[model samples]
Target: MPAADALPIPVGAIVALFLAAFPIFWCAILWLIAGMGWRRLANAYPANSDPPDSADRIRFATLALGASVRSANYSGSINAWLAPSGLWLRPILPFRPFHAMVFIPWAHVRSVASERRMLMKLVRVALGGDVPDLVLSGRLAQAVLDRTKAKKR
Candidate 1:
């Protein structure tokens, strides 16, 4: 046999290719699986607005932060705010640019779910259970508004 034909492919090279490609394949599979599951779950829920035409309709979800409400401007357009306690959304066009915030409004929201256990697990791994505050200030705002309305009557 020729010396060139006698040399075998190295195991290390095969492993190196697998190691490099595995993550990308793993992530792609995970995303596809999660997306399908999510799509099914989403189909199970009635659209928060059944008619789908009403801008007034709002879907409820927990917000991880509340500071977005004060600093974010909602003066002109309909806005949705989420925090750990609850959600706040109003219909209007915001005339001013908001600061000190990255806001994700409800109108722009496509889906939500309580993955707190998963988050807690990640937090435990990364920072040893030092969980950040997940207060729902948006719901509190609604509650206060309700109470004020009740008091006025």
Candidate 2:
């Protein structure tokens, strides 16, 4: 009996195969994200704001150097600047064109609460319905609350 020869692999066939498999690859990625649970991104950075006042003494978050920040549509924390106007949450990584700075105006913040999760207390800032909430360490949270409260006074 003659040995069977390998079938010729055509470029067109290979392209067609990839085209068929691409949707499956995309679906698998979506499925994985959904299975892991989808958390909405938060935009903690605000837009076009005044510079920090020398006399007012803004409270910058030292701990925010590597903190994870989120808004309604963003993930990962950026450095924060607490001015009398509001809290400016900007990307820790520099000059990200797409990443936005979220400015949570003192008026926009509905409340700040401390909750225990993962055996740690986190300060949760509720930014009303227009934005997602922010969770920070208790100390930083207190700092935010103080700044916002001071603004009201």
Q: lDDT for model 2, on a 0 to 1 scale? A: 0.52
Give the C-alpha lDDT of model 1: 0.33
lDDT of 1 by residue, 30-100 (tens): 44532422223223322343232322333342232212333222222334443422233332322112111
TM-score of 2: 0.50
- CA-lDDT, candidates in order: 0.33, 0.52
Model 2 Cα lDDT, one tens digit per residue, 9-128 = 878999999999987776665444322212222333446654465423223343222123322222333466666666666544432334455555677777876677688666677755
Once fitted onto the true fold, the runs of candidate 2 whose alpha carbons sit more than 4 angstroms away are 1-46, 53-77, 94-97, 148-153
Ten contiguous residues with the weakest lDDT in model 1: 121-130
- TM-score top scorer: 2
Model 1 vs. true fold: TM:
0.24
